[model samples]
Target: MTIPAATASFHGIWPALLTPLKPDLGIDLHRFGLHARALVHAKGCGGVVPFGTTGEGPSFSVDERRDAVDALVGEGVPASQILVSTSCAALPDTLALTRHALAIGAHGCLMMPPFFLKGVSDQGVIDCYRQVIDGAADDRLRLYLYHIPQVSGVGLSRKVVETLKRLYPQTIVGIKDSSGDTAHTLALADAFNETLMVTAGHEPDLPELARRGSTGAVSGLANFMPHVVQRLAGRPDAPNTPHDVSRVRLLLAMLGPYALTPALKGIMAALSGEPGWLRVRAPLVALTTDQMHTLQHALKPIALDVDVD
Candidate 1:
């Protein structure tokens, strides 16, 4: 029995939150809660999404993922403020992940098509979602299709979006297009105006989308600069400030090549005046000593108080 809850309004800055870890690489639920809270309080940030590619969702255990959700809910962050991206490579795992996220007070789920295989058809992708939504069995399990074919090798085509909405109009709520293509994102917005709140994954395109019915962004830029993103994404009437956007881009540039897990931890560690908050799992290596120095030098003028270890 699927419990269907009314879908809530979505469209604003959904930050891909950074997960803090202990030096030995254990989940620091306490710090995780603080980060969630921090973003919620930021100007224009609608809420936080904790398990996107930037959040290292693929690298975490099921328990770790659930615990992250638990921490946020326990901290009094409302479900409306969380859009949990329960993207996993396996159908069963994805279903389990969505179930957990919904159970832990997340209002919606962003699902990437299974990436373990290539050249999958829209039918297969639709079936994967059918299984996940079936397992969720609740009104709160609002599914937002995640489209980033460049990485996932599975793009959510127009047919897939239309078919899913037709099949489960209420259950399938929206989409986050990280395909990095303006044409595709624009097309989705034009096709499904009210039925699906299509959002851009890129920050620069927020205003353009807002004009075209795009409600907001699920942005990597918001991880470190939620306030800036919230300004452009959250405040629709505010005039575009090129200087403001450029400032953020400049600061983000100092973080180095944009493989974010380490740079984010490093920033958190620096700000908190603590050690180990910056430590991350292996296979996602940390900055080298010289690299760290370069980042420090590059980021020096940004005026944050991050310290060296």
Candidate 2:
């Protein structure tokens, strides 16, 4: 489970990415790679992850993830540039995933806290990470802690990063601040300025973060909207940057709230010309006909290319 010394850099605009699938619900690893290659080859996309929350990461089996990584890397994307999110429910599973990712030559892996229990203490969260880092035995295993407190319930508390950094400076590495808390991220930027790369998960906040010496984002919008991601990412520190950010927010507004997920899946389906692209895994329903009608009304005009024709 040792991450090679040669593979430690995790940077830039990595779309949390999605796993394209056949209508039959079979894993379309080939189509997945096609999407990956397209993103990797795109102007602003740094790399991709096959099984993120956006990728329906929880819904995939271990074998599917392994094959997905292989397929993407084989398509000419380098191993280091492709960061695999190994965020699972249990410690053993997380360790296995971490090791598997290391074996497949993923540059780094992301981890989510054990979400089965609510109101977890920071120590428990710390122990979970410590166990993963220790078990992997990979000094070069760059671990980006997923900080979506809303979903995970267990926030990786303010002290956790410092403790992890001290214990495993090279291995613990950075964080994906999806907490959406502007003040929290701002504090992190102020405190851990040079220590770790703090990525602003929200695009609207990127310009402000970039000004504060924060790194880029790990955005879902980028999965389907790569060109937009590039434009927003490259908005730069200048007077007119707010205008660009507002334009993106306007797009997000037009796209709607929950529309992001289905619409994103729709984008892949449309692009692949596989209209029966996928149905969200059971317990998670796909958009109804009326809902899709709403999507059609919303996306096409934005030049989002949601048509499968």
Best by lDDT: 1
TM-score of each: 0.87, 0.89
Residue 233 local lDDT, model 2: 59
Query: lDDT of each prediction vs. the true structure?
Result: 0.74, 0.72
Best-fitting candidate, scored by TM-score: 2
Give the Cα-based TM-score of candidate 2 against the true structure. Answer: 0.89
* Model 1, C-alpha of 134: deviation from truth (Å): 2.3
Tens digit per residue, CA lDDT, model 1, 221-294: 67566666667665656765465556666765665584667887666555566656566776787656676666
TM-score between candidate 1 and the true structure: 0.87
Evaluate model 1: give its lDDT.
0.74
